[model samples]
Target: MPPETPANFWGDMPEEEYYTSQGVKNTQSYFETPNGKLFTQSFLPLNQTVKATVYMTHGYGSDTGWLFQKICINFATWGYAVFAADLLGHGRSDGLRCYLGDMETIAGSSLSFFLHIRNSEPYKTLPAFLFGESMGGATAMLMYFQSPPDAWTGLIFSAPLFVMPENMKPSKVRLFMYGMLFGIADTWAAMPDNKMVGKAIKDPEKLKIIASNPRRYTGKPRVGTMRELARVCQYIQDSFEKVTAPFLTVHGTSDGVTCPTSSKLLYEKAASEDKCLKIYDGMYHSLIQGEPDENANLVLKDMREWIDERVERYGSKNL
Candidate 1:
């Protein structure tokens, strides 16, 4: 953020005013999961007919608030009801900050709230999609795998962590050393700090804004977090062929965090005949939020078109 920027990413305007100015209604609440309480937010168009429902998940160390909601607000403005939650160990939710010991349990906690809203009135009948970015991409896929058949109409992934880039991958030797501790070092923040924010973001100004998020975890990757991600990422890649839902996976060729190759793998391996993949020539990992307005808008446009067609093809229960 610039020196003149307010504590809030959107400036001194009240949150409601800020969201209203963005042409969306924003509501915040606490969701009780079997594991713990989660800070949740829902965004919806004020006067437009709801087209479809989208359950979104934010990247690691990021919450549903802050600059992350840029994606949610954009979707809501496009007539989709967007719902997101801070993961179990991140943001204002319970547990140690950014400590993801068990990927399955963490995914389950967030999926609980999503299923509740998805099955509830007004939204249950509507076509629904799962959206995720960065590490959340893997989490969202896990939710999809665990979800009942036909529970989701489609899937969307942005710079998913299905394949780990050389530099971003945690050291196998280090993880093995930690593993020798027998669950002792699982929560320790001793893993290498990859300076991911610097790499994942392309715009310097947006980097400052994302770095300013008070809820963002800036510490070194936790021992268990990296270990589990390594394991689960492979698990996700192995399950790619089982993905039968219509889906769109996008990646920026220049992304320094997650590799675009993994996204291509999903497109190549997935069983969905309707699956689509778009590889942007020179975008960053945070395609929708970290890129310049023009670039971000381009990505959003593709997303809008893809989703509108999916809703039309599948038919929304709302209609």
Candidate 2:
């Protein structure tokens, strides 16, 4: 469903750039979707001229800026302008704290953004590609499912979540706990020690940034959010064969947060004949953020090659 005008959506806060050195240009704008809800967005222009634009979405509990700076820098360096946004309720976007329940609505915001830009003068005809990480990857795929074939030139997913690892708890105990806790309190109750995607972050610098940012890395996932995440995982598991768009997915075997199995499942089941999956041997959940320099470089190398192949075959321009 299309939203009413998103006139109420807010833009990024003042200090987003203080947290990372990637130096995003900070267009710091909001587009009015329908329903008086506004969508938060940022555009980072590449220094070099470009043939395509990349629109990126970050993972759960992560803002677009927190997760996409490195990739944006790389894409910019490679001559592709990058556009990124916080999903509703994630970064600077409007809504409750982490309250996006439906993936379709989240996806629609991008479609709105794309249409809004496509109709504008500067970006009228530029080919745009979609990129997402983790839940953001799932959001991209969900959007692709809703969009027409020309909706995007192609897609790139990093650690896409077909199924995320919930916890190390035993199934019976975990379910019982969920049932008991959910039965008594609201079903949206957040568990302890479970929201720490950044707690054990290997990078001290990144952790400091996360710690410093009050708007980020501080959301408690509701039970509804957890349930929706599970539902989307199951949906992906059941409908991978329907995903026909050419996509490249990258994941790490050692990723304990989102789990590498999800990537394996997507690779094995996705219907796209042009799909490719590259698994990093020892990387963690955030492959681009957590991997060693060489492995991260290789991962980016694979993504670059794939993008080149798509642009060459598709012959689309970056906005």
Candidate 3:
């Protein structure tokens, strides 16, 4: 309720200036989807030829801003155009704060925007990659399942939530009790808070910065959110064989938020001919943003190399 001490994510610098300093052109806009008015941002290489387009999705309680932009900028600087949207109910998007009652509708909303951009001129023929981090990985997977065949050339996941660890799974009894309320408590922020940020970020300084995000949700999980995630994780696990796109899934062995078994499961079950998995020995869940510089860069380097190789193999001649 009080004034936020930090004016922006990166020191006192203006947003556009800071993005320019990072060697990427930044643009923010509101996208009107049938489900909600979504806050979206695009990061493009300043003067470099675009190699491909990367559509990104941030995790639960997170948005496309904050350190998430670091990933976007990194992709853009590597000659890719990156675009991201704040998932509904989080960040500047329209909805009850931090509530996710319907996972399909939420995934659909973001998918619409990504499809629009991917189908437009100068990009339609070019290779497009769908990238997701944390719970955003689940959203991205849903989007992929709902999309037309071949809609995305490839998929990249960082510490995705395709599998929920035993400790993090919501109690069935609790959900049943809440269900007795006839769905009235669906939007309530009453689910157990697993103190996920504490387990997801390894670097203490970076953790502080992530916690300072004004738009980040810092409340207990919503009833429907946990319920839907549990349900959807099972659904995605069952549908793993449906994945046919070239893909790379990465996880941290020490990640307490999402299980490293997530990546392993996907790699084993997916039908994709070209699938890769990377499990970092001691990295935390937020591989790209919460890790120390050398570590984050290490993850980023792997991501860049993976995407670059795919681009060369399947990329288009278009800008």
Candidate 4:
């Protein structure tokens, strides 16, 4: 059974009480990477045997703090060690705010962090999994492609940006113009009408908390950032069949940011023999964070079951 919240707690428990109830040891710090210094947080089970390790990455303009940390806490309670890194330009990481200059550099920085933990003492022998949410999903997939086949035990994606939804996609003319203007003012914010936070989160209170996050980037998308995102999406789609790792992807049917068709396409085209896809009927993009309590719990239940089964079936004997 999962940890129970204290009676005094209301909508959300205090950080100390929450971590104590979950029996998790939490830590946060900054680490240097080739691209820039990155911030990372980890949640490890206390007085319990860890069954697996999950290296996570947050979505665009988001970080390891705020609602994203909630999922890490749950994983720790379930006997899994969770480590998450703030992508460059998000959270406390050093960079231009929400500006993704190059996909390769961004993905490479995460891969380096993950590999460090995977190859470290104690964790070196544990079965490892990659968990990516939203744009982080693209980086996770790219990391998988960059790694050898047996490097990770499994991959998990939540509302992955495999394909940008029609509503959220930028105009082709704008993209062309941006590409030409890349030589100058590449860092200028271009696409400003990003109402994704409103569309993605269903709970009004949680939406407020997310919106109030000081580190959250509410500015328009940058020219170089938008261009790179488009290129990355196209590359992932073209290389879907190249994904041979056992994996599972979950997306909400009502998601307005990333299309559900992306996960469907991955399921149909991926070469992985052991792969699964789950679509929550009316849920929004923020599966475990933005939904009502009941719906969020349901998504969390599915994710836990899927991950637990894999850990049991493929015990931490091989990498």
| Best-matching candidate per TM-score | 3
Among the numbered candidates, top lDDT falls to 3
**Per-residue lDDT of candidate 1, residues 1-319 (tens digit):** 5465465797888988888999999998999988999889999999899989999999989988889899999999999999999999998899899999898999999999999999998898999999999999999999998898889999999888898788878898998899999999999999988888888888899988999887889899999998899899899989999999999999999998999997999999999989999999989899988998998999999999999999999996543
lDDT of each: 0.91, 0.68, 0.92, 0.87
lDDT of 4 by residue, 81-135 (tens): 9999999889898899988979888888988988898889788888899999999
> How many clashes show up in model 4?
0
Per-candidate TM-score against the hidden true structure: 0.97, 0.80, 0.97, 0.93
Error of 1 at 263 (Å): 0.9
Which whole-number lDDT from 0 to 100 does residue 226 have in model 3? Answer: 93
Instruction: Report how far off residue 101 is in candidate 3 (Å).
Output: 1.2
Candidate 3 C-alpha lDDT tens digits along 1-319: 9766675778888887898899999998999998889999999999999878999999999999888989999999999999899999999999998888888999899999999999998788889999999899999999999999888989999999998999889999999999999999999999889889999999999999999998889989999999999999999999999999999999999999999988999999999999999999999999988998999999999999999999999968343
TM-score of structure candidate 3: 0.97
lDDT: worst 10-residue window of model 4: 2-11
The predicted structure with the larger lDDT, 2 or 3, is 3
lDDT value, candidate 4, whole model: 0.87
Check candidate 1 and list the clashing pairs: 1-208, 1-209
Please give, for residues 40-63, the per-residue lDDT of candidate 2 as tens digits. Answer: 554455354566778887887777
